[model samples]
Target: MTFEHYLALFIAMFLVAVIPGPAVFAITSASIARGLKQGVNMTVGLLLADYLFILLAISGLAVVAEVLGSAFVIIKYLCAAYLIWMGISLLRAKPGTSITEPKMQSTQSAVLSGFLLTLSNPKAIVFYVALFPTFVAIENMTYPDILGIMACATLAFGSVNLAYVYLGSQARKLLTTPRRLTLLNRCAGSVLAASGVTVAVR
Candidate 1:
């Protein structure tokens, strides 16, 4: 992939990671209620889940892309539609509620919970399925290329997530105010929708 392509992928993944979601709340809450170690474990688990989704997307969707070929054009529009829908929904969402009770009692549970929480969200898998073909030429995609994508994903996802973990209580403060929360949602939604449109028309 060209450097531009890699940079675009990184930005997309970063947007996906920074948006507040259940996983984000879980990781932050784990850190606040338990410890940084627990939060780190959960982050690791989430990263592993991401890798799993990436692998599945590559192995399964690559063939479909290869056989169907031009059909991926349709898939691109579909993925773009999904992203737009998600963005709109996020935009309309009410201010996020605080995670008062940390459901994770132990580090093992924290990690497991993070994994299951991520796995349960089929959205990320579909995102990867849609994302790979749009950015990388599936026919020429190699193992190293896949690894490179995963590395970008890891850096993007891990950095934002770990930042939340590190911020801990401070992160919660940023979200506590309705004004700040609304602004966050707006910025995230706009970026998400714009990204979708970019993918669709690229």
Candidate 2:
């Protein structure tokens, strides 16, 4: 890909990443509830899912995805259930005698949670499938072109998610008391739950 092509791809990905969606909600909540490490872990998982979708699109599996409409719907519901369950779990968590309560989630668990969330978002798959063809000349696309696009995606997505992690971690610092922590937890949980409901109903 040329420098201009790379720049355009980066711009597009950045525009999309800056929009808070289910994946962003999950990552920020995990960061607020846990810490920077979990947030980064989740970001890695999400990046992996993006790469997978990109591969699928490049390999002409987007048509397959579009054909399996019911499968996507099932994935959406599964994602909604998981989000609601996670939100409730956060709601039930009691603040310990500390500014930041250490979470029980392992690194592997965080990674898996992120992977599932990203994989379940059918819209993301569809977006890439449609978006790529507009900028990428599929008939004459090269390996380097694909690599550049993937690199752009990683940089844009990671940059935005890490920004969210920093914000959430900063918010955690302000949550010095149990009361504030509880309130933050409830608010974040509600947003997540609501996002899930919106996804399901839409």
In order of appearance, the predictions have TM-scores of 0.60, 0.87
Q: Candidate 1: lDDT over CA atoms?
A: 0.66
Model 1 steric clash pairs: none
Evaluate all candidate structures by whole-model CA lDDT and list the values in order: 0.66, 0.76
Candidate 2 stretches greater than 4 Å from native: 95-104
Q: Give me candidate 2's TM-score against the actual structure.
A: 0.87
Query: What are the RMSDs of all candidates, in order?
Result: 9.8, 2.5
For every model shown, the clashing-pair count is 0, 0
What is candidate 1's lDDT per residue for 134-180, written digit by digit as tens? 87676677888888988998899999999988876455355657676
Error of 2 at 110 (Å): 1.7
The residue ranges of model 1 lying beyond 4 angstroms of the native Cα positions read 61-107, 169-202
Kindly list the per-residue Cα lDDT of model 2 for residues 1-202, writing each as its tens digit: 6798788878888988898888888888767766688789988888888888777777775787878878767877877886787677777767643224335367776777677677776557657877866776666778888888889989998899899988887877787777787887787777778767866776
> Which numbered prediction scores highest in TM-score against the true structure?
2
